[model samples]
Target: MPRLMILFTILLTVGAYLLSKALYLRYRHPLLNIVLLGAALVIATLLALNIPYQAYLPGRRIMTSLLGPATVGLAVPLYRQRSLVRRHAPAIVAGVGLGSLASMLVAGLIALMAGLPREVVLSVLPKSVTIPFAVEIARIHGGSPGLASAFVVATGTLGSVFGATLLTWAGIRHPVARGLALGTGAHGQGTAMAFMEGEREGSMAGLAMTLAGITTATLAPLMVRLLLRS
Candidate 1:
């Protein structure tokens, strides 16, 4: 029964992923985000069946492991955009650094004002970055990796849902600007959306995502300590 359940979970996850991708390409709906939709479907199904998350975590971890390779694969798009990246390196670096810092600072301030636990604030401080790096940063700052994972997922979802709209409103229309905004604010999911536009956009977005992760990882702990001290 356990083996069957694991098999079923894997099959269901794949099916949902494909279905959600199809829907996104067909309808162009923000709500049809493949990752978000697939995650929702799997979580709902598991909860309805009374399957404890822990019971399925091992199988889920198998799928999650693929995320690392998938992230590395982003180098393809980035390599393709090398010339453009070189031309705009300074702008991209500045934009991503500012955006990532702003995100962490805002989230940290809100968390502190709300009187949330210090660990929770630390966890959320790096939520705008990728999960693995965010987890490491969170742990170093005496935060919970589990909480960081949850917050990073939430940050990605919110960034994907609203990122494009916000950029348009801010008059950020160039592909480079759009990609930078998405990657800096949304991370992987946003980078995925940027790639859907073109390789150039995707490459820039990947660069932005990488820079944002590195910057946030280093600065978040310092900001947290400074904030707590003051």
Candidate 2:
């Protein structure tokens, strides 16, 4: 019965994504973001079915395992732009470093100021990165891993939906700048959107996303310790 339940969960998740993709293609609207729509559909279905999240954990874990391979796949785009990427290596590092650090600091400070617990600050601190890593950071900080994952998904979805428009409004017409902004702020979903803009944008975004995640993972704990006075 548990295996059957897991199968059902997987099917529901995939079906929701497919439907959401179709809707996105037909409407071509940002709000039709498949991530947001698919998540909502999955959550709603779980609710309607009275299925506990834990009941779907097996299928979810199976899905989560793919994140590593998917992340590795990002290297393909980067490799394609090696010469161009090397030319701007320093700038790329600077942009990603600043953007990623700024996001963590602002979010962490705000969470602290709001009188939220130290653990809560930790969780939000890693929200700018991918979820699997975010969960680990949240655990180290005594945060709710679930909330950390939720925040990651929300950040990615929001970034993907608004990143391009926001960059254009900010007068950042350069593909590199836009890609850095999206990947640093949004992670994988943002990278996917960057790919839509151009191969160069996608490549840069992939690099930014990889760098930001590693930077966040390495620096977050030290910053947390210092911020919390421990």
Candidate 3:
């Protein structure tokens, strides 16, 4: 029964994602993001069918296992853009490092000011990174990994939806700058959005995503110590 339930959920989720992707391509609208649309479709289906969320857990885990390979696949674009990356190495490093730090500091400070619990603040600190990195950081800091994952998804969704508009408003027009901002602020979903713009933008976003993950991992511990002390 559990096996059947898992298969059912996997099919449902994948089917919804395909449909959402098609719709997004047809409309070319940010609000129709595959992640956001797919998730809503899945949740609505489960609720309408009176299925317990527990029934979805096994499938979720199975699907999540693919993330590692997906991350590795990002290297393809990075390789294609290696010359550009080498040319702009110093600026890229500076941008990604500062962006990563700013995200953590801003999130932590806001959470602290709101008087959110320690664990929650910790989770929020890594919200801008990809899920795997965010989850590990949350765990190391005694934060709820589940909450950290949620925050990461929310950040990515919002970033994917409005990041370009925000960047344009801020007068950030360079491909590299825009890509770095999207990847640093939103992670996977942002990278997907970046790919829609151009290959150069997508490659830069992929690089930024990887570097930002490393930067976040390196800085999070010290940031946690400081946040705790404050």
Candidate 4:
């Protein structure tokens, strides 16, 4: 039974991925992001069938574990852009740090004002960061890691869907500015969109996303501690 369940899960995941990819290519809308589409389908199917998240988690984990290797693979782009990065080191660091801090501060303040529980606020405070680091921050701050994952996904989706349009509306035309904004605000999803623009933009966006994740991960716990104390 376990083997059959595993096989079924694998088949469903692959089918979903293929179908989502085709849809994305045809429609090419940010709001219908492939990741979001695939996740919605999986979650809806599981819910309809009354499958507990734990029951399906092992199969999902097998697929998710590959993300680490995939992230490490982004180092190739960084290496390729070493010279440009060196030239813009200070600007990159400052931009990413400021953007990450601003995102967390806004989320925390809104959550607090909305009377969300401290743990829920903490979970959302790091939502703009990358998934793995955000999960760690959530655990440290007494937030639910699963909820943090969902929050991160939500943040990324919103950022990817609206970020470019917002920037254009604000008259921001520089590739560096666009990449930095998307990478810092949306993390990987935004970076993916930035990459689609061009290699230079993609490299900068990747760098920004990594730095933003690190900054947010480092700051979230401290901010939560201070907020709780006060």
Candidate 5:
């Protein structure tokens, strides 16, 4: 694409995020979540201008390339909280493993109950995982990667918006538990929210996100088989 289009797309994406983040900071509301708000603004702007999504591809790829470094940065907080993690290792393992499995089973079962197609059920099975893993798992199971991406985003957005309140209502006061729940259910968005809560929570959330991804990847095929048999 043209240099001008690339620049415009980059500015639009980053500008929307900064603006939404500012609004979120000022209002302190879950509904004003930066990711959700920023995405809405971008989509609305593109649609209003009649800009094809293809025009945004270059900038999207550039931004996506940065995700690796961004994820690696989580290690800083994880390192700082190493002692606590070691102390709580058993709980962390069990919580993340169970949480990941539960998310897949619940999503798949609900889709099956709704009489959704087999492909739709498979796509939903990895909704709680981060997009890369979710897409691959969906592809492996002959599901639509595009649909899987949508499910992952929806799951993460909703989880980031309401997860903390629900945890509090359930009397889950421990930071580790909260972080694990958020990470396993929401992935990246949840990790962002966990960081906003505190460093300790953020570190555990980072760990949980990684562990949950691994656990989901390993167990998803079996889960699909079980759901199919049901």
Candidate 6:
């Protein structure tokens, strides 16, 4: 990639995020989502500039790599919430396991109902998990990583944008329950929102996210094999 193209990618990505953050702060609306807005701005800029995605891949990869450390950072708050986690270990395990299994099964069933191709079904199977784990799950099941990543983003974004409102409507106000639900459904974005709720919420959300990822990674391939067998 040209040096100029790399610079463009970095500037565009960071600039779009900053702009979206400012707007979100002003509006305080779920629709003012930074990810959705930043993605649109970045894509529009690249398209208008006639820059291909390949030119932005390096910068995008750098951004993607940051997720690893961000995920690790969740341990700090989780350490603070250790007693809470210990008290609720059984509930947490059941909640995460059920959430992970239900998500994969539902995705697979939807793909089947829609008569999508086998690879497409496999790709969608991991959509509820975080991107890195989802991509690997898709690859392990002979699916497309690009599709897996896209679906993961869509799932997380939708969940993050409206999940709290839905929880409120249902009268689910317990922080641990809310955190687990959000984390299981939305992954990183949900965890971020949970942190905004409070440290205990964030800790539970982080734990739920990790548990869901591991469960999805282990079960997605098995589910695909079962689908094939059926």
- Each prediction's Cα lDDT score? 0.83, 0.84, 0.88, 0.82, 0.85, 0.84
Better of 1 and 2 by TM-score: 2
TM-score of each: 0.78, 0.84, 0.84, 0.87, 0.78, 0.81
Name model 5 segments beyond 4 Å from true: 72-76, 117-119, 130-150, 188-202, 228-230
> How many angstroms is residue 203 displaced in model 2 relative to the true structure, after the best TM-score fit?
2.7
- Name every residue pair that clashes in candidate 4: none
Q: List the residue pairs that clash in candidate 1.
A: none
Q: Which ten residues in a row have the lowest lDDT in candidate 4?
A: 221-230
Tens-place lDDT digits, model 5, residues 1-230: 47888898889999998999899789876667666678889999999999999888888888888666765575675677778779999999899999998899888888999999988988999999887778778999878977898888788888888888899999998998998888888998898889899987787888888778778989987997888965
lDDT of 3 by residue, 1-230 (tens): 99998998999999999999999889977666676688889999999999999889999999989777876776686787789889889878999999999999999999999999998998899999988888888989889988898899889989988898999999999998998888899998899889988987787888898789889999998999888875
Which is the leading candidate under lDDT?
3
RMSD of 3: 2.6
**Lowest-scoring 10 consecutive residues by lDDT in candidate 3?**
28-37
lDDT tens digits by residue: candidate 2, 104-223: 888988889899987678789999887767887788778888789778878888898888899999899998888888888998789889989998788788888878887888888777
lDDT tens digits, residue span 129-166, model 1: 87877887898888998789878878878877787788
- State each candidate's clash count: 0, 0, 0, 0, 0, 0
What RMSD does each model have against the real structure? 3.2, 2.6, 2.6, 2.3, 3.3, 2.9
Residue-level lDDT tens digits of model 6 in 1-230: 37777777988899999999999899876556676788889989889989888888988887778776776675675676778779989879898999999998888998989999988888999888887788878988789988898888888878888887898899989998999988998898888788889977787888888779888888776888777666
Better of 1 and 3 by TM-score: 3
Clash pairs for candidate 2: none
Q: Estimate candidate 4's RMSD in Å.
A: 2.3
Model 3 per-residue lDDT at 167: 95
- The lDDT of model 6 is 0.84
